[model samples]
Target: AEVAPGAVHVPDWLDLETRRRLVAACREWATPRAGFRAARLPNGGVMSVRTVCLGWHWYPYKYSKTIDDVDGAPVTPFPGWLAELGQRAVSDAYGAAVEYQPDIALINHYDSAAKMGLHQDKDEASLEPVVSLSLGDACVFRFGNTEHRGRPWTDVELRSGDLFVFGGPSRLAFHGVTKTLPDHGDPDLDLSGRLNITLRVSGF
Candidate 1:
């Protein structure tokens, strides 16, 4: 479904097996070396959603090669296969051929109480499409306008295996997860929270 101009939401894009594999990969990436950690905002408040990054460490308003806020360790390398998956997602959604070589993956873990605020992903140098994959639980995704984070927004229920791609005019739109449903994940997954993997072109 086209949620907005240049923004597409493809439901159930990943099959059961694929979701399982991706979840396993997420577990590996969530290790202590480059694991999940709460992000502290510039206001001295911490974000509810815990995040971990690959290829580039994302601060509140910037991207870096190391996590200076944490232990200052280098982030895990972005996998080539994941980048390929992102390209395939863009092709499937937009029905066009383009070189979507994503260099960064921002993985966010949202528990039942975790929620993200409406914000624009403008930290990246590239205006390329942002490919997001959802897993484990369902959530209310709010896609707001580009002018501001106020009204005139649409709420969409994003379930496991769903893919959302935003670019072009919607690239700078304010979007966020309102709330996550508990115990709504596939029983086979055995995950207690929702996992969101967003692929981006850092252009660094």
Candidate 2:
């Protein structure tokens, strides 16, 4: 469904096997090197959600080749298959093949107590559609306008295996996850928390 002019939400986008593979991939990415860690803001506040970045390490307001906040480890390389996945996701959301090179993928984990604040993904130079894939627990996703983080926003319930893509007019829109439903993850997945993967192009 088109939630906004350029935002589309597709529920049950991933099947059981695909979700399992994705969960396994996430687990591997969270293990070594610049593994999953909380991002610290310039305001001396650490984000609630822990994140593991690929292709390019993302900091407070910019992208980097290394995890500057961490031990300065070189960030993991972005997988070509993942970029292809993003392309497929964008294409599926728009109901047409879209050219997109998501150079960076942000994998965020939100536990029962975790929640994201209203924010805009304006750090990237590219204005390509942002592809978001959800797994595990369900959450309330608020997609706002590009103007500000205030009202006039639409809230959508995002469940496991869901896909949401925003671009064009809504590429820079403010969005966030208000809260997550605990004990809602598929028991067979062996995952106890929610996972959100957002694909963005660096245009670099």
Candidate 2 C-alpha lDDT tens digits along 1-204: 998898999999988988998999999888677788999999999999999999999999999998898889888889988888899999988889878888999999999989999999989989988899999998999998889889999999899999989988999899999999997777658788899999999987
What TM-score would you give candidate 2 relative to the actual structure? 0.97
User: RMSDs, each prediction?
Assistant: 0.8, 1.0
**Least accurate 10 contiguous residues by lDDT in model 2:** 183-192
Best by TM-score: 1
lDDT of 2: 0.90
* Residue pair clashes in candidate 1: none
Please, what are the lDDT tens digits per residue for candidate 1 over residues 52-150?
899999989999999888888888999999999999999999988878999999999999999999999989999999999999989999999999999
TM-score, one value per model: 0.98, 0.97
Count residue pairs with overlapping backbones in model 1. 0
* TM match of model 1 to true structure: 0.98
Residue 15 displacement in candidate 1 (angstroms): 1.1
Off by over 4 Å in 1: none
